[model samples]
Target: MVKYNLEPSESILIQSTGVCEGSGLMTAFTDELILTNMNIIHVSKGLFGNTKSVRKYPLNQVKIINGEAQASMGKSTNGIPNLQIYFTNGQLSFKFQSSAKKEIVKYVNGISKVLIGRESNLVANQFAIPGAEIVAETLKDTIGVFKGTLGIKSKGKAADEPVKATKKCIGCMSPLTGTKGQSIRCSYCDTDQIL
Candidate 1:
């Protein structure tokens, strides 16, 4: 995957939707935050724990523009919801949504640390989730905490090779190789000037 750099003024957007309990409606949360120089945005406790109303909160150097802070409950078993979060700044974001309330909290807190660039005990923290513990443990073994995962064939540096181009001949307009002093030869045609 290709990674791009994000400008300092770029915004982070989180759009999360999940099903609540005993209700058939699917609830979603869409939030956008812009990072300032040194400002701090604090989210109240109720903003995450309870899904009463749509709320917006701010963290240090980040602002929340919009958020739908409610969970949807389903009357049937097919009412489970999946939440998705998108990070615009060359990084993928993760959101938490589960039938178990405790698992939801743990997933949120674990991913929050990763977003803020903090030390993580992600393995221990994600054990409660169904398959998250195995995935996290696999990641821990393969890529560790700081470094990202590499493919099986990728052994060393994965930097791309630089591209090069040369000038063309003024006479035939063909492509030329080498420099002025080294050799004046055109690779496209058999033309030599000052070899």
Candidate 2:
């Protein structure tokens, strides 16, 4: 088992003990997957392949995780399990053989449980947390504060009077926080203002 440097509240839910390899993009690396409440950690070697290192994927940013069987009909004894994890940055596909089917099932179940719990928490927090993003969007008409802070201002009866509060992100329709000279980038969908 590859030892992982866990964070303060991070606790291991499952660990892939034996031979398991992860391959994606231009990289084929062997690492033990450690699933925690907060992250999915890959314990492997660093740049020189000598020192041990870890790559962590936060649970919130994960798009999806899927596991499917790759077993053949004739080979009844031996089963294969392929696990795929999708994230905002990238995704990884892992093919596990030998005694991996059982281990992969364990990992899938553990991750499902954690994800369900997080979803419920998010739903509950939706009502509790104040919407700070909404308030920031409504400040377009009132630019005096920004002018004073940035030391830039125009004469009385300013020509531009577009309400920033009314401006919504083109992708997600969420409210946007825009500066006068700077282009607005949507925080929700990560869309850059490119014309």
Candidate 3:
């Protein structure tokens, strides 16, 4: 039950305990990985449950390499999934139990989302296209006005010209029954055309 001191606006996203790979000559140790909105903290505890060391890696400075399937040219030594965080100066690798596969995947996904959001400055459904609807409505109204002024019908046969049954729809190539110079809307694809 280690207590964490988080900065303002920082929140913990995920926490897991696993075997952390050590550098050359150093033996592996059980470490607790705490992922937060701002950083990932690795806490190494002693036998008496006392914290021996703590390392913090800022989210912006690190790149996460997920399990073998997701990492490019990655391979698992013992079939157990590994999560590696690579930073500018060094890297950290942690191997978790097979049963924690789902949790590891979810944690990696969350981190990826955070990293993407930081890079793009946008999130899913964060903004609305209010102008899109207005633009569409205005275009519709303008088209209607133009059609009325120019004596253009969306779908009808010309009153003076003889019907040409050989004319086909440009969209679907289906035979159309309309006079030459008449604007017709295809029944199959609803495409507006002049036969």
Best by TM-score: 3
Task: Estimate, for each residue in 15-122, the C-alpha lDDT of model 2 and write its tens digit.
Answer: 763324443333434456778988877776444445366778887766643331111111112233455565777765554444655555555556656765422222
| Model 3 residue 79 lDDT score | 48
CA lDDT of each prediction against the hidden true structure: 0.36, 0.57, 0.63
lDDT (0-100) at residue 24 of candidate 2? 32
lDDT of 2 at 5: 75
Q: TM-score, each model?
A: 0.21, 0.43, 0.49
Per-residue lDDT of candidate 1, residues 1-195 (tens digit): 112234487433322333222223443322222222222111212325542333223333221123311221112334332222223322122222444334344334433443454322332343457787789889756664345443334345543332344677766887665544555666656677652
Off-target runs (Cα >4 Å) in candidate 3 are 22-29, 64-76, 118-195
TM-score winner between 1 and 3, please give it: 3
Better of 1 and 2 by TM-score: 2
Superposed Cα deviation of residue 147, candidate 2 (Å): 89
Clashing pairs in 2: none
For candidate 3, write residues 44-130 as lDDT tens digits: 877556788887888777644431112111124654455655666666666554444554555555566667643211112223475
Candidate of highest lDDT:
3
